[model samples]
Target: MNNDIDSALARFAGAEPHAGLAGLEDRVMCAIASRSSSSGLAMGASLSAAAFALVLGIVSNAVPLAEARAVSTLAPFGAPSPLAPSSLLLEPR
Candidate 1:
């Protein structure tokens, strides 16, 4: 290895290792983390808001709600269920 290259690498790895980028890293991480957290919080909040609205609609429409909703069904109306939990693992006895 050339002495010049060796010395340059040694100094680079030994010292701050690019002072400008190093300093910028902390600030960048803080900004990124903050933005990510805020975005996540906003998304979660919006999901919660939508869920609340759905529940409110269901509750308010309960009286006029379809009676067919009482029975468990896999289809929109009624049909053989392909996705229902199977009791095949239970003892036949």
Candidate 2:
């Protein structure tokens, strides 16, 4: 039994390691280079999208401010009472 185990161990120990995919190093380097180049494009697109959103947000909010104040002015204005039911509701009751 011990000899059988020893022979099996010897066979395993002498077995060659697997030969991996050919040109693996070149494939990995190419993938890294391609990713690095594409990253610049991705970054530029992200920045442009952010800038456009900022501009749109500013325009949308800015355009509404004056109109909101005008609409509010046309209604009677005074400080709302703490106990007012209308104030508690999202819209005027």
Which has the greatest TM-score?
Answer: 2
Best by lDDT: 2
Q: After superposition, how far is residue 40 of candidate 1 from its true place, in Å?
A: 0.8
Residue 35 of model 2, lDDT score: 96
> Considering summed lDDT, which 10 consecutive residues are worst modelled in model 1?
82-91
**Global lDDT of each candidate:** 0.74, 0.79
**Least accurate stretch of 10 residues (summed lDDT) in model 2?**
67-76
**Per-residue lDDT for 17-49 in model 2, tens only?**
667866889999999998998798899999999
Tens digit of per-residue lDDT, candidate 1, span 1-93:
579989998887888655567679789989999898779778989999999999999987876655555455457446646544453344364
Show pairs that collide, candidate 2.
none
Q: Which regions of candidate 1 are displaced past 4 Å?
A: 1-37, 64-93
Please give the lDDT score at residue 40 for candidate 2. 84
Q: How many backbone clashes does candidate 1 have?
A: 0
